[model samples]
Target: MGFFDRNIFIDIIEWLPENDDLIVYKYDRHDNEIKNGAQLIVRESQVAVIIEQGQFADVFYPGTHTLSTENIPLLSDLRGWKHGFDSPFVTEVYYINTKFITDLGWGTPNEIMLRDADFGIVRISAYGSYHVKVNDPVTFLKEVSGVEDAFTTEMLDEKLMPFVLSNFTDTLGEAKVPALDLAMKYKEIGDECEVLLQTKFDQFGIEIANFIVENISLPESVQEAIDQRASMGAIGNMNTYQQYQMGNAMGNVGEGNSEGGSVNSTINDAMQMGMNMGMASNMINQMMGMQRNAQAPQNQQAPPPVPSGPGAPPPVPGAAPSQLSFHISSNGSQYGPYTLDQLKQYVAEGRVNKDTMVWREGMPAWAPMGTHTETASLFGGMATPPPPPPPM
Candidate 1:
């Protein structure tokens, strides 16, 4: 057609993507009319649509189509003008890209909240890419690429990104996967999100081909806490670790023995910690023994212990009295396992009180030292008789 021609008569109609990203393109037909017998070329990975006054007339797949009554029944039925053989028709055509669009990215623009078991509520962010393709040309044109000359993946991303993030956050939160375990569940989460997001995109005739979860990032504070937790191990064997610490400190103490101040200080500090651990372990064991007694089965057979008389049961053979060594609690620090003689000195100095907490071997639990038969005599002088009040 020449510039002088007022009306251009077109014979063939088709479209080659302007770029790889082009998803939908409108066939530009500036005042051009297609003769009734014009050919419509639809290529592979593309779908051609015919529109009459904003209404979908017909859709064509990969083939050469003649715009006639027999080939396009939808448009022919709408127009119903078969009287003239050389008549021209004015209509709009759109071509949709059906090829998979890969590497289209998506990410959470802001941190989303997730409830975690170990760390309670945690804030997290994630990013990944997706792939998609046009599933239905007619619906895509109406819902997504409406009234646009061309639609690219960049434009689609603007709409798809939010949908992806919405579904992704919902999926992750609903799964309630712990923040620490999120790394291991990335693939499972991605697969689920793809399925969920595809359902939402189906309305716009976009199919999600693939979704990926590259990395889910925890907050800096959470990461630091995790590092510290790893550094301070959930120590499995306290006994072994305590032994290692004591051994190492003793080696150091021996090396510094000539330096009197440093040597004594190291010995005191190391020995105090060792004593504290030992007493704490004993206290816990005592509490556990009481718990076992309380929970003992009621129907179980048991004989009451004999009182101290002729009927008393004999002590087990080869057993001897355990050494009387006591631990005193003062100012929240446990002091030495003082022998009976040393404890008498502590009582004389007014440092040990009748109500002070103390524990020793063969005791069921820690208690006021005066409550014990062995230690009651230590506080004998502090008790007074009430004979004068009774006479009154």
Candidate 2:
């Protein structure tokens, strides 16, 4: 075709990207004819690029401009026609949208490998939304749009998702925040990720206006591990936790049994805890007793053990009464053969009461405190009245 035949006239030129477009149609026309006086319209948040022979000839911002030799000297010069051509000329016109596009979704394609404080190395998935806009339309067209007929949000999505994911992974790895804590630091993580992305986005003539992290997640197994760790911390003691698990298992067994389930397991756990508590109490008592004994007068002799047989000798008249020891029966159980001093302490602490049955070496049978002369001193304080006698 002749050079003149190749010319096509464009009397009116204008382009507005669709509401969803990110980098919209690069130009209204691709290397088409433009009449010298054609009206070119540019809208807000938009720029129009004019290309001649694959080279940028001119750029127009928002507003109306008449396409003429005076306004497009670069095109005229490129054509080597100083006087300007009377006939229509060929040029490529591209319109770039610079408005912020919000709510573009992004997510990691595969699990991101990261180190967790509690779980060591773990894999996690993250997803969220972001907003982007063309900050430099010229560079955007040259680098992002390239030869594409139209650069769309969808295209941008396809192109930018990898950057988003890879950058996010890198930022997360650098932050070293555990997966379990990501929820609490979502905004912080997102902010750091946004900062990392901004530099790269600037190179592409795009800006990330806002970034959001909707959620960060862990695999089921990892989550379960977290839950177990949490449970252990909450329980606060390994032995107690073992007992708790055993108790739960025992409870489940009871639930499964149609016949009368034994209370034995529950009793066993309670008894075990009680025994541990008693052992601790006994150790404390021993220590305190040792300290008291050490501080006692050096000349005072240690008390002799009470005689055990029927022919045992009587207490010496001059010596202080032998420290009497008695066995306690409480709540249908035998507790201790505690010394009178220990029993007095127990009474003061309300651990032992008048209603509690008592037995001693010389006692004919188990009897209540009010009936025992040797133990009556335990409740002699001028306080609340004595408890009623135990049932016969």
Candidate 3:
């Protein structure tokens, strides 16, 4: 085909004969133009322009376009003629929906479903879908694999699947519980995975829509340990909290007691009683001091002796005869002085020894002077006293 005879109008249906075939179009080649009744595959980069011929028009598939002075059928020459061609260029866009899967050991699937636990002992499952659309067939063929191999199961499982799983597991491990505990922390883990993978997969021209962690599984042993720890912590916290509450209650009670009248009365009574006890203690101390002073020994000068009367006889000489006195036995008797020597002589002569009573005229009752010895001549009695006269 000549440069001027090149057909520019291309139909997509005519160029692509096979379902999975890729066509390439170029704008500088003459043979790349479509011929009458001949099928051709076009490159995606080829640019075409419309042409008209006498009573006929032709559509050129994407391919090389040539221009020359030679009188040949070209797309610019066809004004009214109708033609059909197929598109050689196809553009596809790919979007990736990533999900994370964790590893749950022996009873992975069952435990994930049953307890719905999230821990290091468990595994996570990450799931994702690959969405693809044709964009530029030529560039896509040069840059990437064929369309059939674009979204192959093996490619997805190999390239992106491991990334999804690793990202998800790491994110789940780093996920923190919510402050309010209103929602599962896995949702936050999913969000973290989305952010991380978005940056990692940017070069692949793949847009990651969503990354999610469907389930997390825990081992039975880990679950049991967690339960035990929770129980112990709860009990300990309850005991400590109860003690604190009781202390607060007691403090409040004490405060109330002080605020009421009872404590006031008790305090007042204590103050008054203390004052009274203080006064009594002071009085007792004063009295003890006075008693001690009164009982203390006194130091006084001796008194002067009294002088003897003139009528009193002088004391006897060295022998000092005994001073004795007696009464008379007769009625209306008068007594006299008796000397001790005289009395002793009378007693020696058996005049008087016992059974004798004497009375004086001034005496009120008879006096029994048993076994008397007169030392003076005061009494002349050696007989018993007589009875008194009867009353009138």
Which prediction has the highest TM-score against the true structure? Answer: 1
**RMSD to the hidden true structure, all candidates:** 12.6, 11.0, 41.3
TM-score of 1: 0.63
What lDDT does the true structure give each of the candidates?
0.71, 0.69, 0.36
What's the lDDT of the predicted structure labeled candidate 2? 0.69
Query: For residues 353-392, what per-residue lDDT tens digits would candidate 1 score against the true structure?
Result: 5766665554545566677665666877533321364554
Q: What is the per-residue lDDT of model 3 for residues 1-392, given as tens digits with 9 covering 90 to 100? A: 64434364222212222322222222222224433433233345322222232222223335543322122244323322333332221112121112121221111122121222333334233333332322333333333333332233334335556666666656644554322231366566667777887766554434455454554544455556456445544644432333233222222222334455343343344345545544643553453231222322234211112223343333233534453333323222222233345445434544333433443222334444442323223335553435686998
Model 1: how large is the Cα RMSD against the reference?
A: 12.6
Regarding lDDT, does 2 or 3 come out ahead? 2
- The residue-level lDDT of candidate 3 at 220 comes to 57
Among residues 3 or more apart in sequence or in different chains, the pairs in candidate 2 whose N, CA or C atoms overlap within 3 Å are 26-94, 26-95, 27-93, 27-94
Name the top lDDT candidate.
1
Give the local distance difference test score of model 3. Answer: 0.36
* Total colliding residue pairs, candidate 3: 63
What does candidate 2's lDDT look like per residue over 1-392, in tens digits? 67555345677888855566657575555567778878999989888888889888888899999888877888788888765567787678888887888859998878888877666678888899999998887788777778677778888888899899988888888888867777899999899889999999998899996689998989998887667556545645433343334333323222323355554554355456656754643553453232222322234222223323455334334543235556655344443445677667656655445656776555455567755776777788433344787999
In model 1, pairs of residues that clash are none
Q: What order do candidates take by TM-score, descending?
A: 1, 2, 3
TM-score of 3: 0.29
Alpha carbon deviation, residue 158, candidate 3 (Å): 3.2
Provide the TM-score for each candidate, comma-separated.
Answer: 0.63, 0.62, 0.29
